[model samples]
Target chain A: MRRPDHQTTTLTAEAVLAPYLREQAASFLRGLRLQREHSAPADAGTQRADEAARALRHAARRISGTLHTFRGALEPVWADQLRAELAWLSGTLAREHAYATRLGRLLDALHQLSGASLPAARPPSGEGASETDKERAALGVGAARAGALLERRLTLARTRAHSAALQALGSSRFHAVADAVALLASEVPLSPSAAEPAGLVLHAPAELAEQRMLDAVAALPPDEAVEPYNEAHDALWHQARQLLRLHRYAHELLRGAPDPALVGPGHALDLHRDAAEAAAAASAAARTPRIAPATAYALGVLHADQRHEVEAARGVFRETWPHAAAVTAS
Target chain B: MRRPDHQTTTLTAEAVLAPYLREQAASFLRGLRLQREHSAPADAGTQRADEAARALRHAARRISGTLHTFRGALEPVWADQLRAELAWLSGTLAREHAYATRLGRLLDALHQLSGASLPAARPPSGEGASETDKERAALGVGAARAGALLERRLTLARTRAHSAALQALGSSRFHAVADAVALLASEVPLSPSAAEPAGLVLHAPAELAEQRMLDAVAALPPDEAVEPYNEAHDALWHQARQLLRLHRYAHELLRGAPDPALVGPGHALDLHRDAAEAAAAASAAARTPRIAPATAYALGVLHADQRHEVEAARGVFRETWPHAAAVTAS
Candidate 1:
């Protein structure tokens, strides 16, 4: 599939995707170099290098997958064009591995020179020079030779210009792989919540998110009760919403869309059945509100000092104190 | 000078300074250990170790200078207390260095083991039967050996928790020396615009600091012009202020009060004279408005279409047009 020249186009996805890929690749390569330099020679060094290589490969695969996905979404002609481009990229990667092998040799040579005593022996010069002069001249020659070799290799590859393309492919592949891996690694069994049958239940990996929710609730000031408590409640609601979104996305990807039969024969035909049920439940919950102690204290303060309705405020205080105490103990 | 209590009653200055000195010592020792392990040959390794030692000594001297500065600020009795604590710290550093030499030898032995191929001998009695088990067993042995040696040393120095103190002192010293060396090595001549007119300038070696500033600026939104420009202006103001503070502090230490003669006449009474001048300049620059095409277009869109203030919006557009054109041309 190839995109028609006349098709409405903003920024080409490749234009955005290319630089992003290249940056990720460059960062990964730099990290690899640093690890190679700093890590002590041990089984750990080998293990670390293997892990890094695995990560790089995973990243490359992700980029390839993303390109494929984008191609699938494009018009038939454009899809074919993108697929062809990806095919070319895969071919280039094969050749690039050869270049990497040569680069490895160059690196090894550089490492050797670094380890060698400074003022290395002069390359066979016919001149009868003093030892000091010979040493100084040799040092200059060795440095120049290294620089020239590196420059020639770089020029051969047109590395400065082509690096961007290499980077883009690598990064996209990485992200695709990472996303797939995360999906596969998730262990929680999906289920429907009892309180809200329409809502998908999530078993949190740990109590950390829940603990943060509790702390936020406890930290609310007595004087500014409702707003603070509501903010925390909202935060928890959002966290729950995120879990729902993830569950929906995962379910869609894994098992296609929701089955109409699950909601019952007639219910599936009703377009707003799920929405109406959810809203009704929410409104009922809102009517029978759970008041917390901080809420009570805030109401008390408002009544006593801020000249709010005394009897109404006292009623709210009495209702909320038990929940507030329970929340504080937790 | 000995503190009267001998064990306690030292000033807060001495407490802070003692830890700083100890950290410097510990850092120096760690660097020495790293050098000994990494350096290829005995002679070269010794030279590197000696260099690290020299750096530690230089840091120790700086700590002594700071102590003297503290002494000048405190009462005579407190000054005596600080001096005693400083002397004890300096003595501790010397002793710590001796222990570090022994530690370096052990590290060197471990470094050799990392590079060595395992001997094709029968597995030791404690070695495991399975391949995975053997690996685990070897690791356990290595850990046990290291731990035992460390514990033995700690036990021997149980009199005053001398081993822990020494280790802490060595680590601290190494860090201080490394930091000072980094500062000295990386220092670059500040641009005239960034330089302070008077007072000590604490800089993170110009290249690193400049890179950090540039990174921060680059991370800002391209259209959000206020923050990037303001940050540069603020940093200059901050630098000037710091210099002024240091000058005042130094002057206070040197003399009972700031010297009017050194500062000069009426205008010199203000310690932050340079910083105030820079801040005023920055403030004036910020207030000096620049009209851009985008700004004019945004204003026109907001007032003309949204607010329906055609006449007022036209006036603004006309006023800004020339400056906008000038900006575009540039």
Candidate 2:
């Protein structure tokens, strides 16, 4: 890795991205340290770890996304390898969180059906006591058992994800990635193209990101987004969410911050992703062999709840996109 | 209060209804005794009380609905007064349960948005640690506070309802109602028409109940039931739910049990009622003055979730209604 002349750097791609990369690298390292220090059994410590995880995940996404978007300005081989490693790291960290989220969603939905708001409160009434008898009388007999089944499955999945994430964090490969990031904080491996003017280097990709997102948004069938929500459309909407995210990240790279026009739609997309994934988890849980009809019925209801969430998110996106598009165009 | 001669009793409306009234009165008394004996501080005792409440409520609904349905065969003044007292008793008992149910629903929805499935688990993390940092990072800043605020308001409401229910149970009016029920167990106050044949007295009213329910079901706009769930339709669906319940009760009186054909649609209506009510609670919570934007956002998501639930329930009802109607017609 050779450095461009200090005077030349002021006008080159290296000048703009070197600082951004360095900041993300530092945040990643700092998150690793904080996560280790805050790994206590208390709720506070777990929260700190989760926060550290978020910081780490955020930095990883920005670095990986930037590397891809700016590959022309960087050493191609090194950028590809680093991007792959960041992807691996992000995936590992996110797995347990995904399971936890899905479990929380399913259990909350079950509680909704059972009319048992406080499952922790062991009602003195025996059998079917989690809810008021009125609720139980209406909700039928499968809620408690359904909840227990979902809990058992999801808890196991989360625990396994936790173990896998821990294993990855401790692996030699993770350490290698960490070492590479540390070195990059001080010296980025740049290509001959890195000497190009910053705007000339970044503008094409930024525009492409925006165009791709707009195309996806335009492709969504406005007609199907409402009544009789089709699951098939969920994939298309999820792609739009991904594209919007890429566009936001590209804006951050080119403009030093995400586009203000993108924020509202970004939030709606995040909701769409969470809800769609939650609905899938509920559907999976509903398929447990030999489960009680009541349990199946409750899971069906839960699945429907998430699907509605998916539609609701889509509704928000539809409402927000026109305004966002106008703002962006202007 | 009078009994017809033994030979004529077999053919009279009183012959058919007296046994039903006696059985309900006995169950109500039994429920009262169980509730008093089991009113301990433990979860089990609370559950016992809840069950007793259910039994009492069930008996009251049955007796009250029966009186209304069979008013032609019963003494009007006595029937109306007793029905009014039963309504009072049922309302008092149901109020606490309703609040508890609504609170549970809101709390669960909050938990769903927060991504905190196990709120009881005081994780090592502090502050926003109720959810995975990933969830908090995505859900925005208002979730914990929103949850706290909703919990406070709903908890207070539930407590007040509990107090009112307790006060009602201890009132002299409750004792008077109980005395009337006990007397009815042995002797029903009958109009001269009570001597009419059982089929002549009960069949027309039972048929009327079924007709009303059918008409309401027919009035529902199938087009609005899917995406873009309109809240205005919720009240109409709720009315349908009530009518269905009345129809089921009428069937029980004529057929010795609820019409088997009605069971599937009945469950769907129950779901519709629950989801519609939950959506309203979520909307109300969202309107709390001076709440943070994040809190409001979360509530908006929750309200949407419940609305989806309402639609889901409607979907169920729609799917089941045709089959139920076919079976009932057969």
TM-score of chain B of 1: 0.20
> Using DockQ as the measure, which candidate wins?
2
State the number of backbone clashes in model 1.
40
Give the proportion of true interface contacts each model preserves, from 0 to 1: 0.00, 0.01
The prediction achieving the highest TM-score against the true structure is 2
Listed per model in order, the count of residue pairs whose N, CA or C atoms clash below 3 Å is 40, 21
Supply the TM-score for candidate 1: 0.18
Put down candidate 2 lDDT per residue, A224-314, tens digits, no spaces: 4433224445566767887788777766765666777667778988888888777666555655656554454455445556767777777
lDDT of 2: 0.69
| Model 2 interface CAPRI class | incorrect
User: Could you list the chain B TM-scores for each candidate?
Assistant: 0.20, 0.86
Model 1, C-alpha of B188: deviation from truth (Å): 38
* Candidate 1 deviation (Cα RMSD): 29.9
lDDT (tens digit, per residue) of candidate 1 on B1-330: 222222221233333334344544465445545544533334432666457545655454444443344333224354354345545554554454444443443333333322233322222232222432332233234323432443345334332334443454457654554454344233311223223311122111222323333343333223311111111222332332333333333333222243233233212212222222222221221122342222211111111111111122222323332222112101
